[model samples]
Target: MMDIDVPGHIEKVAELEGHDDRAWCVAWNPTKPVLASCSADKTVRLYHFSKTDADTENPSVTFVHNTTISTGHTKTVRSIAWAPSGTTFATGSFDSNIGIWEQESSDEDDEMHGEGVKTGEWECMSLLEGHETECKCVAYSTSGTLLASCSRDKTVWVWEVHPDADFECMGVMMEHSQDVKCVAWHPTEEILASASYDDTIKLYIDDPSEDWFCFTTLTGHTSTVWSLAFSPNGRYLASSSDDCTIRIWERIEQHKWECVKVIEGQHERSIYSLSWGVGKRRGDDGKGEFGGWLASTGGDGKINIYEIYEPPSSSDPKGREPPTHTLIATLPSAHGVHDINHVSWCPRQGYEDLFATAGDDGIVRVWRINLNGQ
Candidate 1:
């Protein structure tokens, strides 16, 4: 029941309805106008949006139901991730399998929607089966050359993407003693990070011999780590946990990371998801010297947004200061008494302030930051 009319707050702009069961995750297409959401209903829905009045202060965005894939998974589809090419995506399901999806036809065969927006039918191109239990999360590398998946089986798998929709398993990491909750890749590197029920985060890198191995283990959270996100610059990482806190880790040296800051007293329950985006704000020189915005939501049925500022210039000879963050906005009961399972910023450049959240209400809600409160 929080008032969203205040300045510098986040406003709910659209509610997308289709899934008959709880929606678990949402992902934005990196190169298209499409947004994808997966649900416990064992389906994946795609929505396309277009913006009007791009130069105006109050731009309008219209979202249309693009299509829905039956997803063939026997159980709930837990997570989805889009490739950098936007031509393909991957889904991890509770059925203990991963599905690689792609359009059945090329763009020339796509159907046209409002304003000539293109839409296509997608099909599962490959099915990867290895996880012993539910596949909790999936993510593609920045270059789309590798894909990472973690599961309740307590293992992380790395796959090499081939041209004809083929995936070759490169490694299987069993570093976590309990269920792995999420997996994320660094924005500009091949480094892969995974959070787990073991209350730890592990980072992996490809060795010179072409084998992927755990390089470091990060520990600080007192409870299960639920999610992980890297700053836009990839120099820092943020992790949310069942401890109801977020920890920021900075890369201090080559292959070394240290916890520099801990964010607390923001959420009343476990933090399920968080995302970092290149925000609209800039530094004094009118350049993007500062960092981005971080959005988080969880079992408390609330959404919080924080503005992350770059560490100030310091005279310390050893290193610079750690980044600082301020809570900018929050919305309670974002889904009307339903827990939000995921939040993701739109990856497309011009729409950085827009983000989408999936909730236990079986709805995907789109929101925008109103810095001017208009």
Candidate 2:
């Protein structure tokens, strides 16, 4: 059975329903509560709440940023990402293209010359071309140099986007046996990870000598791995699968990863999404590299969090219960229908405890966890 509980009631802060079709992807600005949701309607909508410094009681409860911008993408937008700098954003679409949008002051004078300040709004700056099929995922490198994208066409395209240059496809990895489902950039390094219907997760690293070839492929999932994440510390990885379980992977050795433990019995359907807490747990011993907490979504339409823990010590050899990783909170109807496709915490964890998920229901849900709740 899918373990689900919605203790926090929801409030309608705001809603934008102009999409012509289902909205499959929504992403929060890495640094702000500002959000962007893309839909099959061939359009992407932008929203920004004014008081970004303040966290809402229930993010879904009100229309904090009633402003909207509809542009970019010609088909269903499958994935959206906020650049690390938070001033620019990127999105991938079934239209087989990726576009970069940035917010800048309208005065064409100081703006283009780098004198004007950022306007905190988004506008289509340029479109990236390379993928041959629907681009399912797009991610920016940690150092903010490259943008990695994957598609149903069975390939991953790495683009070098920096210093305002025309997005150039640096390399392409076409080893997946089936449709590629997800792509993620290493939080701190120049590495990339991808999941595919081929029942495997693969890693790609830049090799100046080998033309940046795919030097590593991770295999272990019985079913398709829908989502993958590199821990904030870059020492661990987490994957959600159709197998209805979340697997924690540790770098047992260089170029090789091992499944350390399994987080099971939380969801009843395929695990559509998974994300490790982004930072160190407060009041923690600070010895280990990652595992502050974890969140996942699946066919059951719920978001569940757990404290990633070590095996019980000798005093409790009988086995202690899993650490509370605490379902500290849950996201309701997280897009509904067990058809949810993705769930991700903002890049910087512990900030408003904000996370977003998108799926078949045509809704991109944003949530905030209140640490000081009654």
Question: Per-model C-alpha lDDT, please?
Answer: 0.91, 0.69
TM-score list, all predictions: 0.94, 0.81
Full-model lDDT, candidate 2: 0.69
Residues 1-374, model 2: lDDT tens digits? 45446434222234445556666776766665466777777666766544333565432333344345565566777778877877777888888988788775565534543322344556678988878889988888887788899998999888887676368778899989888989988787888899998988888888887656776777777898888977766767888888887777766567777776677777888887777755334455543333555778877887776555543333352333332344555655655553666666655434435566666766666665544442
Question: What clash count does candidate 2 reach?
Answer: 13
Best candidate per TM-score, number? 1
Q: In model 1, what are the clashing residue pairs, if there are any?
A: none
lDDT for model 1, please. Answer: 0.91
Residue lDDT tens for model 1, 1-374: 43553347788878999999999999999888889999999999999898878778678898899899999999999999999998899999999999999986656655655344344578889999999999999999999999999999999999999998999999999999999999999999999999999999999999977789999999999999999999999988999999999999988878999998999998999999999998777336532247898999999988998888876545352477678787777888899989999999998877888999999999999999887635
lDDT of 2 at 82: 76
Give the C-alpha miss distance for residue 219 in model 2, angstroms.
Answer: 1.5
